[model samples]
Target: MSFDKFKPKYKIHSETENYFKLRAEAGAKPYDQLTVEEAREGNIANAKRFAGTTEFEGTVKEFTVPSKQCSDGIPITVYRSKQCDLCVAPSVFVYFHGGGNVVGCRQTVDTICRIFSRDAPCVVVNVEYRLAPEHKWPANHEDAICVVRWVKMNKGLLGAVNRSTVGVGGDGEGSRMAALVCHEVPDLGYQVTCIFHASAA
Candidate 1:
């Protein structure tokens, strides 16, 4: 049976209803029916499409930088608001995209990073970590730690508002990584001022 028949009875906001309509039209396959690679590609495509519709008042810069914790260099996209040009150092928010540890990349959260950068008036670093089932548990977590550490160590280079005002955050599986980073890296000199998690509803 088609899942649309099970739509919620309660009235949802128009925007939400439109979002569901878009998803339904996208014809996403059941996760169980797809291979890891297929799921990843599909999620990326969806994210890119969603991102294309968003308009944020910020500048984005892409980089492929080395990570001490992971052999494969990390890919990061930095988002900064125009106001940031006036400030000597903008605060930083390191973001991880949601994918249940199996699907997603930096592009998956491109729009989110832009929103955060504009609204928070801080630099948003969207991290692209290796996925799971292929690169198992703790791998993503380790990558989170590495990215946070790398940001902390290189805050000046990142144009951070202040080296001391760093934060970690994510959605879904990415949230788990953010929480882990906050919990595991307490000893780091710079404090993670915020830990934002957009858990699934």
Candidate 2:
């Protein structure tokens, strides 16, 4: 059957409608059908395409956080608003991308980080945690905790004050990770001012 017949009747913005149409046209294979490497490549490609088409008015910097086993450390991208320097001390927003612990990287959510940095007027840090089943359980969660600690320890370099507001956010699987971080981290209440998940009501 034609994909158009499956389009929702509910009202949606033209841009969103176009996106859905394009997605349908692309005929991308389901995640379950693709190998992990193939899925990662597709996810990265989609992110790059979206980044290219969208306009983000923020300064982006790349950094790495030391991981438990890997000496290379975890990759992270920091997005700061253009006016961040004008503020007394900008807040920090750590973001985790929403793949099912298997298919996303830091670049997968570049646009989301840019949007948060610009709209919230905060420093947005995108974490690139190791995925599974290559890494196994608790690896992603462990990385999340480590990144949070790293940010807390280096707030000065991140353009945030010691007691400045810090928040954690994510979508889908990433949301689960954010919630876990908030729950499992000791004395997190003293540092994290908020926890935001797109799927949370």
All candidates: TM-score? 0.80, 0.80
In model 2, the Cα lDDT at residue 38 comes to 80
Candidate 2 per-residue lDDT, tens place, 1-201, comes to: 133554665555678656545655665567777787887787787667555644667678889998776578988998887867777878888888877888777777787778778776788889999899888888889899999888878887776788766778787678888888887665553222333222100
lDDT for predicted candidate 1 compared with the true structure: 0.72
By lDDT, the best candidate is: 2
Badly placed stretches (over 4 Å) of model 2 are: 1-18, 51-58, 186-201
- Give the per-residue lDDT of model 1 (tens digit) for 1-201: 233544665655667657656766777666777887888788877777666745676567877667665676888888877767766667788888887887778877777677777766788889988778888888788788888878877777776634447888878777778878988776433223333321121
The deviation in Å at residue 9 for candidate 1 is 7.6
Clashing pairs in 1: 89-160, 89-161, 90-160, 90-161, 91-161
User: Ten residues in a row with the worst lDDT in model 1?
Assistant: 192-201
**lDDT per model, in order?**
0.72, 0.74
